[model samples]
Each structure stands twice: as structure tokens, then as C-alpha cells.
Target: MLDKKRIDCFTCRHFYITWDRDFRKGCRAMGFKCNEMPSIVVYQNSGVECLRYEPKLPRKQK
Candidate 1:
């Protein structure tokens, strides 16, 4: 069994979830577009290569 918490990269001390613009940057760096959902880490205490994490954007509604 696994325990998962609801949080983002900026909040957690580990993991990194890429945002829209940064997602693009990551894609460019990886030489591929971020088409497979812009998530960098989905695990706790995972090692990260991201040091430029920013807060997650507020949700938008139609």
C-alpha cells in the first residue's frame, strides 16, 4: 500500500510539477514537447533536477 498526499512541487520538499510556460521549457530541454501531462514527479521524497519551481497557478474557470 502507498500513502499519497495532495500537494504540489513548490509545497513539497521533493518532486516537481511543471506549469504551462515552464512545461514548455522542460519540453524544449528534453527535446520533446510536453504532451504526456506536465507532471515531473508523482512520488514523495523523489530526487529532483528542478530548482526553479514556482507556485502553482490558481485554477481558471469558464
Candidate 2:
């Protein structure tokens, strides 16, 4: 089940925050924004979990 290992958009590289209040959340890979997490939006629209999930790289501590 998708719920077993949830795809967290916050940890994904493609995840982003948009200026639009209605669609503040976004996915770069999918090129879309939404109120909820991008993964949830993808699942809602496509009836399948997001396939473009890539884990975000750790930022260097400068």
C-alpha cells in the first residue's frame, strides 16, 4: 500500500514552495502546484503514486 511507505514531498528534490496561496506547494518534475503536497496531488489526479520522487541532496554546511 502507498501508505506503508509514504512519499514525502518535503524530502524530494522536486518539491518547492510557490507564491500562489491557493497552490503554494509545487513539484518541479511534474511542473505543477497545489494546496496539498505535490505527491498527494499527483496521486489524486493520476490514481497512482508519484514516480518522479528523488531524494534531496544534503546541503553543505558552510
Candidate 3:
């Protein structure tokens, strides 16, 4: 059995929630906004995992 890695846009630093009512999510790295999560959209269009996935940094508490 092959192990599959989960690709979540929420985990990426480039991922961001949008204010647009039509497109709710976006990827800064990819330079496009979409209605669905960027990771899923990219995978569906490209048939591969996101190449620009960068782990989101932990928020600093003041």
C-alpha cells in the first residue's frame, strides 16, 4: 500500500481566506483566487500536489 500525503491549503503560508463572496479562498504563491480551497483546485487542474506549499509559521503571542 502506498502512503498518501494530505495536502491542505490551510497549512500553507500562502493560503488565505478571501473577502469575495464568490471566491472564498486563495493562494498567494499561485497568484489566483478561487471558490474552493487552492490545494484542491490545483490538484484537480494539475493532477499533482502543490509545488509551492510552505508550512505556515506559528503565530507569536505578545
Relative to the true structure, candidate 3 reaches a TM of 0.85
Per-residue lDDT of model 3, residues 1-62, tens digit only: 11377688889999999999888899999999999778878888988878999999999999
Per-candidate TM equals 0.21, 0.87, 0.85
- Which candidate has the top score in lDDT? 2
RMSD of candidate 2 to true structure, Å: 1.6
Candidate 1 lDDT score relative to the true structure: 0.36
Top candidate, metric TM-score: 2
Q: Please give the distance, in angstroms, between residue 21's alpha carbon in candidate 2 and its true position after superposition.
A: 1.5
Model 2's TM-score against the true structure: 0.87
Cα-based lDDT for every prediction: 0.36, 0.88, 0.87
Q: What's the best-to-worst order under TM-score?
A: 2, 3, 1
Count of clashing pairs, candidate 2: 0
RMSD in Å for model 3: 2.8
**In angstroms, how far off is 37's CA in candidate 1?**
3.5
Candidate 1 lDDT over 1-62, as tens digits, reads: 12443333344232334565634323222333342322343222244333443455666897
Candidate 3, after superposition: displacement of residue 35 in Å? Answer: 1.4
lDDT of 2 by residue, 1-62 (tens): 35656799999999999999788999989998889888887877888989999999999999
Better of 1 and 2 by TM-score: 2
